[model samples]
Target: MVDNVSKQERSNIMRKVRSQSDLENVVSKALWKKGIRYRKNVKSLMGKPDIVIQKYKIVIFIDSCFWHACELHGRMPKSNTEFWESKFERNKERDAEVNKHYLSKNWNILRVWEHELREDFDGTINKIVAFIEHAKK
Candidate 1:
């Protein structure tokens, strides 16, 4: 499928997309209100997770439904189907690799989907807190 815009224009548009999303900020604020301390995208950690509770050795990933290819909400771009498919495949592969790395180090990873957060933000926050509490035990 051909893109309507020039390749350079498309590249510029893509570059304008924010790397960090609001989901991360929402979760961060929730945790802060509860007095739970966390680091955002720690460079030293594998995959640089969205949130990290060093005390609990827990890592949180605020996954985008579109980017992660969520079973319910993910869709391939009609304009660049092949390119998008390959990109999503690589993303899934990288996610798997990161999971393996964390597992080997006995770290707890919680991947929350964008749709899940949007549908029930409070519930999602509670679940993350619960996981952290459980890890403490």
Candidate 2:
């Protein structure tokens, strides 16, 4: 299917798309305000988790619904359906692999979907807080 916009316009729009850590920063800021400390985008970790509390051995991932194939909100693009489907499928497979890596090491992982944060910001924050608290035990 042909897109409505010109090629250049589409390129420009895609260029402006948010980088991976944009949502991660927002969540990190909130956690900071709550007096929780964490490291952002630590490269040593598998999948480079968005937020890491090294002291508690906890890693947090703020996954975009579209990218991570959230069951409720993930929708393949109308155009390039096969391409998008394969891309998302790979993403989910990689996520599961990352989870397994951490789980084997006895690390606590908290995955927060984009929609979860958007639909209930405070609730999402509370959930992370609870996870941190529980992991501390």
Question: How many pairs in model 2 have backbone atoms within 3 A of each other, for residues 3 or more apart or on separate chains, i.e. clashes?
Answer: 0
Across residues 63-137, which tens digit of lDDT does each residue of candidate 2 receive? 998889999998878876776888999999999999999999999998999999999998999999999999999
Q: Tell me the spans in candidate 1 whose CA falls farther than 4 Å from its real position.
A: none
Model 1 scores worst on lDDT over the 10 consecutive residues at 18-27
- Tens-digit lDDT string for candidate 1 (64-122): 99999999999888897888989999999999999999989999888999998899989
Error of 2 at 104 (Å): 0.3
**Candidate 2's C-alpha lDDT?**
0.89
Model 1 compared with the native: what TM-score? Answer: 0.95
Model 1 lDDT on a 0 to 1 scale = 0.90
